[model samples]
Target: MNVAAVLSCALLLAIWGLPWSDWLGHFPAHMIRHMGLVAVVAPLIVLGFPRLADPLALSPLAGAVLEFLVVWGFHLPVLHEAAMASSVVFIIEQALFLIVGLVVWAGCLRTGGLAGAGGLLLTSMHMTLLGALLTLSPRVIYALDHAGALQEQQLGGMLMLAIGTPIYLIAGLWLVARSLEDTKDEMA
Candidate 1:
């Protein structure tokens, strides 16, 4: 589909093949199951369709609630730990991510003329922050004992966020500006 979706899928494939897969083997069966759910399916959905902004058009309060749940829900320590410990939890977490991502993407899309650029940028910010939290936890929240691959996963997560954030912001601003200019010209 689009470049974003393509890249996400590629990344997911790479993660699946990495050394961490071995550690995942150690996790309880339920956790492994959930990991597959999130790791395999969530990205496909996000990258599969371009997000439309209108879905994000809830009242301010509702929007805030949605954002809160999306960003903080899975990251909660207990939830995170459970997900890492069991496959079922992991699947649930990924499902949450997919749902939240969809909502966020829709919000971006509804922004109208600047949908492309702005939506991408906001999504990037959301993703980067989420990744950072996942990667930067001081203690091993997920794979309690697997330090080696966990460390690597953390680093990779951080790198993705650090690199992706600016790119999204810049692209979003450019699209918004371009849309504004178009509007101005129309008025002129």
Candidate 2:
């Protein structure tokens, strides 16, 4: 929607592409880095941009669905495995990430509303659950384990949740605050 949002999406793509490009050999590390770039850095940047302030004003349900897809889809064993497999899988995964990122970014930057808050909360919860799942796993999941970087994969998953949840929560709260402020301003 704006330069910042565009850049955020670009950056996310780049991160997702690293493993496939062979710029990064470790899939788990790449995934972790990608998640960090998207879930953490991207949101903060989008939150600062005024142009993204009313995503719901554009397409409410679409934006919410995208957010859900990004967070929940990444956690699924099938999707995660596909993402770590090959170039084709990487492309699909990145595409999904981009769509999801746009939705979440739109929600955060555009009309700060209940839908925006719900999307942010959902993403945060999913990321937290993902981290917990990784930590609890007896062995690294197929995707990361197959990448031959089990230790890094496990660490990455833990780090994603550790870093991602806080970012999501803070952003969620900020969205909530903005929503309330808007309501108060409207009432006044």
> Quick one: best lDDT, which candidate?
2
Instruction: Supply candidate 2's per-residue lDDT for 59.
Output: 48
- Compared to the true structure, candidate 1 yields what TM-score? 0.57
lDDT of each: 0.53, 0.63
| Model 2 poorest ten-residue lDDT run | 51-60
- Tens digits of per-residue lDDT for model 2, 13-78: 656445532543464565566575557545645554545534423343566566566656765778
Model 2 spans with C-alpha error above 4 angstroms: 1-27, 40-64, 143-150, 184-188
The TM-scores, one per candidate, come to 0.57, 0.69
lDDT of 1 by residue, 59-110 (tens): 3234324645654666566776786678897667666654554454444434
